[model samples]
Every structure is written in structure tokens, then in C-alpha cells.
Target: MMKTAVIYATKTKHSKKLAQAIGLFLDITVQNITENPVLDDVDLLFIVGGIYGGASMPELLAYIKTLEAPMPKYAALVTSCASGSQKQIAVCNILEEKGIKVLDEFVCKGRILFVSATHPNAKDLKAATDFAQKIVAGGLK
Candidate 1:
């Protein structure tokens, strides 16, 4: 059986909620990136974070840099925000530079600060889960 890890960082809990939904769908435990940053044993890795000022969480980026050499073979990126696509390229670039093959990416609307706080609703969570399932079916190689 292939081993998978669902890790994430969040400030307003939007990313955490999304990560948990993916974890439940994938039958994998969700872990905070700060608590469990090492991924030496995971066959497939999914990193999720919220977008702030057009960038993923700084802590997440720092943790990615700390990953032991020889990054995981298959990895996916997930980001959430009002725009969803915000800061995706920056995170994708960081993972690609680490020699990790990014297999897929998912972005969904999240509750923006105090502006538009109604997000990550049923629709968004369903979309995230669907994305994760597709990535799993694509093979973790």
C-alpha cells in the first residue's frame, strides 16, 4: 500500500478545514506542518496552506525548505482564499525547486479576512475532495 501524508498550515483555519476534508477523503491523518515537517517516509505528499498577500504561509514555505534532501516523488499543492489561485505559482515554484514532482494542484474559495467571510462551504470542500481523489487515481508515482 502506498503511504500518504496530508499536511497543512493555517492562520484563520480555512486551510486547516480544507486539509481535514482531504484527509478524511483520503483516509489519511491530517498533520500540521510545524508539528510534522519531515516527509522521508511518505510516498505521496499533499501540502495545503492559505494565501496571504499573494503568498503561501511563510511558516509553510520555511518548513518546505527544511524537508530532508531527496523530496518525495509525488506531491500536490492546495491553497485557499477568496481568489483561490492567489500565490499558487509561488508555492508551486518552491516545491518544484526542491526536486519534487508536483502531480496536481487544487484551489478553492476560502473566507477572506473580514470582507467576505462565507467560504469553504459545502461546495468548496466537495471540490477539494474531488481534486484529491483525482490525484490519487492518477497514481502516486
Candidate 2:
């Protein structure tokens, strides 16, 4: 079996909730980027975070930068934003530049201040979990 890991950087807990759901469905542990977890021998890594100021958190991007040579073989993204936009192009670029193949990304509405206030709720968690399952079953890495 492939080793998998789920790491998330969240400000309003939307990304955290989704990461936890995916970890639970995959029977893996969910890690907060604040923990500074390192990916070692990870076949598939799930990067979960929320958009702020129309971009991924700086902390997350920095952490991704640190994952150079030891980077996972494959990666997938999960993002949340008030706009419900799936534009984490910056993060995608970094991962690709690190030679980590980005298999896919899943985006959902996230609570950002007053917007998307009801997001990352039960429905969102289910979708995130389903998406993770699909990625695993779809032969990622």
C-alpha cells in the first residue's frame, strides 16, 4: 500500500475540517502545518489550505518550499475560499517545480469572514472525503 499523508493550513478551520474528514476516510492522521510535519516516503500527499487575500497562505507556500528533495512522489490539493474558486495556481506551480506530480485538486466554499459562513460544514466534509477516496481509488501515484 502507498503511504499517504494529509497536511493542512487553516485560518478559520474550514481547511482543517476538510483535512480531518479526508484523513478519517483514508484512515490516516491529519496534520496541521503549524506542527511542521515533514513528508518522508510519502507516496501521496494531500495539501489542504484556505485562500486569504486571494492567495494561499504564506505559511503554506513556505512549507511547500521546504519540501524540496524529500518531496512526496505525488500530491493533490484541497482549497477553500470565499469565492469558491479553484485557483491555487501558485501552490500548484511550486509543487510542480519541486518535481512533485500534482494529480488533482478539490475546491469548495470556505468561510472567509462573513462570506461562505456556512461552508466546510457537514456537506463539505463529505465531499472532501469522497474526493480523497476517488483519488486513492483512481491510482494516484
Candidate 3:
């Protein structure tokens, strides 16, 4: 079986919760990037985070930069942002630059104070799980 890991760099807890849901779905533990977790030979990496000021957190991007080639051979992005637009292009680009194959992405509404406050709800969690399952099941490649 291919080894997989779920990691998140989150300002708000929404991304952490989404990572937790995906972790639970896949029976794996979710990691926080702020903790400076190191990955080793990960076959697939699920990078979960939120968009702040129209971009992914610098912390997340920096962590992604630290990842060298071949440890994470593949990646899937899971994002929580008010725009809900599969809009983590920076994250995608960095991973690709490192030669990590980004298979797909999952985005859902995230709370911005009163805006989208009800988001990352049950429906979003379910969709994130489904997306992860499809990636692990090789549905993306």
C-alpha cells in the first residue's frame, strides 16, 4: 500500500478540522505545519490550508518549499477559503516546482468572520473525505 500523510498550515482552525476529517476518513493522523513536522518518503501528501489575503499562508508555502523531491511523490490540495474556487494555485505551483505530482484539489467555503461562518460544515467535510478517498484510490491518476 502507498503511504500517505495529511498536513496543514492553518491560521484559522477550519483547515485543521478539514484535515482531521480527511485523516479520520483515511485512518491516518493529521499534522500541523507550524509544528514543523517532517515528512519521509510519503507517496501522497494531502496539503490542507486556508487562503488568507487571497493566498495560502506563508507558513504553509514555506513548509512546502522545504520538501525535497521524491519524499512526497504526489500531492492533493484541500483548501478552505471564502472564495471556494480551487484557488490554491501558489501551493500547487510550489509542489510542482519540487517535482511533486499534484493530482487534484478540493476547496470549500471557509468562515471569514460573519462571511461564510456556517461553512466547512457537514457537507464540506463529506466532500473533502470523498475527494481524499478518490485520490488514494487512484481516481485522479
Q: Estimate candidate 2's RMSD in Å.
A: 1.2
In the range 64-118, model 3's lDDT, one tens digit per residue, is 8887645688899999998788478999999888888899898899988888889
Q: Candidate 2 residues 1-141, lDDT tens each?
A: 799999999887888889988998999999999899978889999999988888899999998988856679898899998888856889999999989999999999987668888887899889888889889998963
The 10-residue segment with the lowest total lDDT in model 1: 83-92
lDDT (CA) for every model shown?
0.82, 0.89, 0.89
TM-score rank, highest first?
2, 3, 1
**Model 3 lDDT, residue 21, Cα:** 97
Give candidate 2's error at residue 37 in angstroms. 0.6
Q: Report the Cα lDDT for residue 45, model 2.
A: 94
Task: For residue 22, give model 3's deviation from the true position in Å.
Answer: 0.4
**Which residue pairs show backbone clashes in model 2?**
none
For every candidate in turn, the CA RMSD to the true structure comes to: 1.5, 1.2, 1.4
lDDT of 2 at 46: 95
Q: Looking at model 3, report the run of 10 residues with the lowest lDDT sum.
A: 132-141
